[model samples]
Target: MALKILVTAKRVEDPESKIRVRPDGAGIVTEGVNYKLNPFDEIAVEEALRLKERHGGEVVVVSIGVDKSQTELRAALAMGADRAILVRHDGPLDPAVVSAMLQKIVEAEKPDLVLMGKQSIDDDQNQAGQYLAERLRWPQATFASKEASLESEAEQKKDPGVVLGADGRSLTVVREVDGGVETLVLALPAVVTTDLRLNKPRFASLPGIMKAKKKPLQELAAAALGVDLAPKVVVKRLSEPPARKGGVKVADVEELWKKLHEEAKAL
Candidate 1:
């Protein structure tokens, strides 16, 4: 049987371009900002695609968001996932709620390999992948930076570096650690979230975009998944940072020193 890989993606407001800020010291309103896929998730998708190429398998991209997320899902398909799945919603939910939704997706997919970005840039919670793994009772390797062989060196001396399981369960992954990389030879059906170092994401060409339309996309409601989409926490309001004022230029070194000692307090 071919290997199965599940990758999680997210559509987030692009922080690169400026967005409108609230006048009342509230957080920047994201209601109208242009959005893009989380960069780390893109790298995870790229790694999943590469693994499929190397070992021969199917890559399924999953995303949890409102209807606007379909654009991001389609983008994943255009990049080369065999299919896409969307856990649709209307607005932001707490990360824990999102993780609950993802647990349902994991139950449905039952993939040998589960992958996701380290964290979404928007929230930066970095908890979904780990939470999903815990919910599914699967071993997780987070911050994977490279593809790894799922075999021992002694075992690889005879056959391919990759090992096979009697029940079709085995995996090898390279993850990042405190000082450097840690290569983990683990059993299959594992959750592995990727970091930015995993791989460079690809651009979707026009032809690829056309091809993506043919790929299968399955949609599921959060309610249908038997999970409460209600948030455990709430964002009461948001605020923008205070604007900066121009600085005065000193006339000479002595003046600069005086200004530093008196006003700037550098002394």
Candidate 2:
């Protein structure tokens, strides 16, 4: 049987572009900003497509936002997702609300596995995946560097390599830890969040883009999902980071050492 994988993507400001706080300090200035798929979320989409390719399954990509998110979802479809889903709303959504809505989608889709970026580049909360797993009472693996699975006792000694699953009942994944890696064996219907090293995301080709235009895309309202959207936390203000002053130059090593030891108090 083929595995069913659901991946999550989000629209975010192009990280390369500088972000500015609104004049009133209410929020970010988005009037003329460039928006793109979150880099981490794109990695999630790529990983889902790869899993579908390797295991012969369907890959579904979903995003939450206003109509603008449709473009990002279409980008994922162009990268080989079978279908796309857009949950429509026109305001900022907190991680909790995002997870709650995702829970509803998970229950509705009933996919065998869910793949999502470890965190959205815009908010960097890193909470949605974990929250969704908890709300659904399913196993989860986050910050995964690569795929893995623990074999059943009968197959434990067979090999120590990239095993997708053992007994077709559970999955083991390798997570990037502080200094090395950690392995986790999670049962089917699990959540896995991707990190930077997961894989390089592919760009949509000309042919793929044309095909994506005809692919199936479903739009659903947040109200239809029956999830509350009230946020627990509110953004008080948005501000830019402090700028650094130019550094002073020293004539030689002695002068540098003196400056470092005395002025900068290094020694």
TM-score of each: 0.81, 0.90
Please count the clashing residue pairs in each candidate, in the order shown. 5, 2
lDDT at residue 203 of model 2 (Cα atoms): 87
True-vs-predicted CA distance for residue 112, candidate 1, Å:
0.7
User: TM-score: which candidate is best?
Assistant: 2
Ten-residue segment with the worst summed lDDT in candidate 1? Answer: 154-163
Candidate 1 residue lDDT tens string, 1-267: 477989988998786857666776345676668898888888878777766765678999999888888888888999989999998787665778887888777777788888899999887889888988888788888887654333444323322223335455666666779988787766778888888656667788899899999999999887788887778777777665576888898899999999999998988
Model 1 vs. true fold: TM: 0.81
Model 2, 1-267: lDDT tens digits are 578889997999999878898889888888778999889889888777766766678999999999989999999999989999999988878989999999999998999988999998889899999999999999999997754333344123323222367466687787888888999999888999988876667789999999999999999998889888888778988888887888888899999999989998988
Global lDDT of model 2: 0.84
